[model samples]
Target: MPLLVTDYSWTQTDSTVYINVPLKGAKVGKVDILSTDEYVKVHFPPYLFEAFLFEPVDDDKSTAKVGNGVVLISLPKRTNKEWDHLMISTNDKEKKKVIRQQALLKYQDKLTSESRSKAEKKHAEKKYALETMMKLEKEERDTIQKMKDTEREKTTAELAAWQLNQKQKAEVETRVKLQRQRSRQTQIKAVTEEQENQCSGEGNVCKSEANCKKKQVVLPAPRLTGNIQVTFTPRVFPTALRESRVQEEEEWLKKQAEARHAVNADTEELKDLKEEHRNPDWLKDKGDKYFATGDYLSAVNAYNLAVRLNRKIPALYSNRAACHLKLGNFHKAIEDSSQALDLLTPPVAANAAARARASVRRGSAFCQLQLYAEGLQDYHAALKIEPHNIALQADIEKIRDIIQGTTADPDTQ
Candidate 1:
């Protein structure tokens, strides 16, 4: 977030940063815009290159600025967790191209059944999208039309409720106006009554007892009395405009949802196209050969390219995870292992054994970060799958001993 030297208003509670970017909303995809006191990094998916640039302008406030704070950076997405392998992917574009070309050549002749299947699926999708677009032309598919009846019902209910609120508010205002008018009229009437009482009741001075004094005569003072009615012209309620706005907002939401469906359809089509190019099984043997030759970086690359080609095999992820661990990229190692674990099956069997192996490797990395508790959890989980594995058994005992020794007794502390 940027500083507000003058004044600023923030309505959202979610963590947000104020960017004075020249473009308003060009940011996209799943990414975090992280900033420290001295620097900022925009992490992006592996395939996308940065396209946006920010420049600050001197506004009416006239704050003088310093030299160029320009930063040019490219964020890369790690598709199958290849982050920690040191120089795994060459920084030099030409070298990277060579390595990538070599990697492709290493497996170019062997397209698996899965690879062909993905390509077929992608072609079908493209065909379908084109055919649909041609047919629709300007007439987009109303995917939200299926929800028309429901949406109509919901909108109707909202409109009705809003109308009722308007009517109620009108009634309240009308009643208040009438009541106030009545009160004013009543006050006038009361004043008149008091004056009339003062004038007509015991308010006279006897001149004399009619000179011969058998009867007394009184002279009356002026008395005022009358009916009073207060009336006011009708005022605009402002409710009709408000109700119209509410209905408009609901309609806008419906339109936005429809737009989302259209975008989602296109997104899925593009996803299929990308998947066709990333079938993992196609490069499995090639990656395995690299693994065998102790070329961990190449093995990681082969696995990555294979994963991009196909993702149905958990074993490939696990194998790539092993290479990542060897290269000190624990984040990537953990990610691949976690994914493999999710795909692994047959709980407590061979599948669990594979998953347990991954767990141990990830746990070892966790221990390196001094995350003993998380490390212990992974180790314990792994033990559940392979209770009698000699290596894991020793790891657990050592960790337990370390934890106990390092944790001081509460009384002593």
Candidate 2:
């Protein structure tokens, strides 16, 4: 016996690698596909096809499906790189072993038959064995597939029956609920009419009114007028006027004390405020240092100080936006980026660069927040500023694919 090799074809694109192998008489459970980051192997009977790629692939994203007399393998590339070649090497080593096993299984019984001579018996046995094996393999595959189909049909029928029963139950419950509601309304109307008839007589009233009147008590009117007069003397005064004058003096004293305390507190605060550093450049430098050290919170504080001192500096807002973006504060990043864009005086080279950086950071934050449309708009704006950046282009493409349910192939796009 000799080794056998089955011919196959493959194609590659920027994001995917596709391989199609013909399986004319293949059976389920007889075909196996093994894949890793660097290699792919397909084992089917006497054929064993292996491929070693030039670079790694995303094995988790790859898939293989057997249908239409073909095994189609789709490999998603880990990175957007072109494949120089399909496979590095191939091997087929199990041909003789498989043939010997089949021959022994099929011809062992025929070897003991007595009607025919050895040569003629051997020839007939070989032909019958091959045909019988093929037939058995086909029948086994058909039986397995038939069982799967039957199970699927059973599950579908059960689901449909369950849905129909739920619908009917809901309809019955709805009807019962409507009937109960109508019965309750009729009962209420009858009770209301009986109450009206009972209350129709001059001496009759509702029990609620009787209870309400029972809980209320009438109060008597005052007999004397509410009047009082006060006069001030040198040492003595009316009782009411003296008490009122004392209360006014105490309130004035308390307010004077509070005002003095507040003035003292303001004086101390003013001293601290006068001593506090107010240089915008120094604050921006402190923020830059904090950002470089990955202290985003501290950097944000420093940037806030700088912005308070000088609101016209666009770099302060853009730099702070980066820190906010890193900290997962997407709303703050958008606000800061919008501020940077607003503060830009004109579209000079430096201003354009700053705008592009702000836009990219804002776009990335928007994507993290799942606001794809706004993210796309910011990304397009960034692209216009830095049109030749490959990384930005790839990001735009990936974002588009994500928005489209991961179906848009980068190469095709």
Taking every candidate in turn, the Cα RMSD to the unseen true structure, in Å, is 29.8, 33.3
TM-score of 1: 0.34
For model 1 the local lDDT of residue 384 reads: 85
Tell me the lDDT of candidate 1. 0.56
Candidate 2 is scored at a TM of 0.34
TM-score of each: 0.34, 0.34
Q: With candidate 1 superimposed using the best TM-score fit, by how many Å does residue 301's alpha carbon deviate from the native?
A: 1.0
Residue-level lDDT for 300 in candidate 2: 95
Q: CA lDDT of each candidate?
A: 0.56, 0.74
Q: Residue 201 of model 1: what lDDT?
A: 58
Superposed model 1: Cα runs more than 4 Å off: 1-279, 346-348, 406-413
lDDT of 1 by residue, 1-413 (tens): 11111221111112222332121232353232332221222322221111111221122122211123212222222232322221233346676445433433332222233456887999999999998887786443353343466677888999999999999999999999899779877876776566555445585644543332332223356689999899966433322234535666668778999999988876675485454344555578878889899999998887876775467788888898889888888888888888888788656565777888788877876776555546777887898887888888888766654433323222323
| Candidate 2 local lDDT, 1-413, one digit each (tens) | 11234588989899999998877576755565666666666656545565666677786688999878788999998889898877644343365334333433333223223324675879889999999999999997797578668778898999999999999999999999899779877876776666566666578866676754453434456578776888756443222234536876678779999999998886665456433447778888989999999999999998997786689999999999999988989899999988898887677886788889989988988887766556877887899999999989998877754443323323324
* Steric collisions counted per model: 12, 0
